[model samples]
Target: MKKEELIPQYLQDELREINDIRPPYSFEEITKLKDLLDHTLKQEKQLEEAEAYGAIPKEEADITNLVLTVKHFVLQESIKDAIKQLENDIEEKKRELEELKRGN
Candidate 1:
């Protein structure tokens, strides 16, 4: 099966948006994104099955909302990681400046 097929149709637009962003994703990131979507689809199927069996309330088996939440979560995590890296880089530059001053 095509790697893109692993992601549900509903989530394809989000993936495209990610691809359109600057600094295109690496192969590893693409693989991880596919894996994450595949896992999410599996979980969605399980939720649907549970709802069918009456184990979960029908209203609670909102797959659309679940997918959106996952997308939001992934975006949040990526932004947080980028912010952390920037902060670390700023600190490193500060340390370099201090060292240069001391050496003069």
Candidate 2:
């Protein structure tokens, strides 16, 4: 489950930023941003399952093997890219936020 499901997720230090932002969000824009965050969670769960099961190729799956390229790709590289996309969304939404304020 996303930690966001357990507790609200946002700028921890500026939570009022959350309350102040009202939404009549553009479905296209919000989905585009949310998809990035969702991808990371999906990848993480898949990585965990691969590790838990024997699905992982032995070389990348275990320390005694040659390298962990596949594991690193699934568990690290992809997740990092998703995270970066979400970070970018923070900046991308500034204009939308300004628009929201105008509605008030």
Top of the candidates by TM-score = 1
| Residue-level lDDT for 76 in candidate 2 | 45
Q: Kindly state the number of residue pairs that clash in model 2.
A: 0
lDDT by residue (45-81, candidate 2, tens digit) is 6656887898876544343121223333333444455
For all predicted structures, in order, the TM-scores are 0.48, 0.32
Q: Give the Å shift of residue 37 in candidate 1.
A: 18
Pairs with backbone N, CA or C atoms under 3 Å apart (clashes), candidate 1: none
Q: For model 1, how does the per-residue alpha-carbon lDDT over 1-104 read when each residue is reduced to its tens digit?
A: 78556556857776566444332444465555556556656766776678778886544456454665676566556545555666777899999999999999
* Cα distance off (Å), candidate 2, residue 59: 9.4
User: What clash pairs does model 2 have?
Assistant: none
Q: What is every candidate's alpha-carbon RMSD to the true fold?
A: 9.5, 14.8
